[model samples]
Target: MIVAFDFILLLFVIICAIAAISVKDLLSAVYILGAYSFFMCLLWAEMGAVDVAFTEASVSAGIGTVLLIAAVSKTKRRSKD
Candidate 1:
């Protein structure tokens, strides 16, 4: 049961990672990347790596995301299209 759930979570994380890369919009991509990082943290926690998961959550999903959003907000929102 847990294996199946972890597999599904991994799949979703992969999808989010791909979406984050392929999306045209920057903010959407950043948010999707954050979600991907969060899912990774979840997987780590599930695998009994609470320390690693906490670090990932605090850095990638927390501070990194905030930095990205701040940087994005300082620049133009739309692409040249």
Candidate 2:
């Protein structure tokens, strides 16, 4: 059961990664990257790396996402294509 959950989590992470890269909108991509970071945190926690997971959550998913969004807000929101 745990392995199944891990497999699903990994699949979602891969999907989120692809979506983050493929999205044209900068803000949307940042949000998707944040989601990817969150999923990574979950994966780490599941693997017993609690410290790494918490760091990923607080730094990557939290402050990192906020900073990316703020940076995007200061620039153009759309892509040239």
Candidate 3:
């Protein structure tokens, strides 16, 4: 069961990463990147790295997301040049 859960989480992380890269909308891509970080944190917890997971969740999913969003906000929603 634990292995199965890890597999699922891994799959979810991969999908989110792909979506983050392929999405045309900058905001949606950033949100997906944040989701990828959140899943990575969950995967870390499942692997018994609680402290690392905590840091990943707080830094990646929290601060990283905020910074990405702020950067995106400074640019146009769609690119023309």
Candidate 4:
């Protein structure tokens, strides 16, 4: 395993997690969470856990993202804040 690559992915995962939580927009947060999931998938794949990577890609980054986006779309765009 490449240490530098792992660190890069870990950094991205942390950034995405922070961005997802800090963003006020629901859709943007969902997208960021999806990115976080993707980065986690990459990390798992790099660590030789292809099954985990596939599951993360199919579940979190895939269906979870779609569902979250659809739910967000159903909400009012403008927030009271």
Q: Name the top lDDT candidate.
A: 2
Candidate 3: lDDT over CA atoms? 0.90
Q: List the residue pairs that clash in candidate 3.
A: none
Extract clashing residue pairs from model 4.
none
lDDT of 1 by residue, 1-81 (tens): 279879988899889988988888889988998999999999999888999999999998999999999989999666643
For candidate 4, report its TM-score: 0.89
Can you write out model 2's per-residue Cα lDDT over 4-67, one digit (the tens) per residue? Answer: 8899999999999999988999899999999999999999999999999999999999999999
The TM-score leader among the candidates is 2
Off by over 4 Å in 3: 79-81
What digit string (tens of lDDT, one per residue) describes model 3 on residues 33-64? Answer: 99999999999999999999999999989999
* Model 3 TM-score (2 dp): 0.92
Each model's Cα RMSD: 2.0, 1.4, 1.9, 1.7
List where candidate 2 sits over 4 angstroms from the true fold: none
lDDT of 4 by residue, 13-80 (tens): 99999998888777788888999999999999999999999999999899999998888889864444
CA lDDT, candidate 4, residue 60: 85
Candidate 3 — number of clashing residue pairs? 0
lDDT of each: 0.89, 0.94, 0.90, 0.89
Q: Give lDDT: candidate 1, residue 52.
A: 99
Off-target runs (Cα >4 Å) in candidate 4 are 78-81
Q: Give lDDT for model 1.
A: 0.89
Model 1, position 43: C-alpha lDDT score: 91
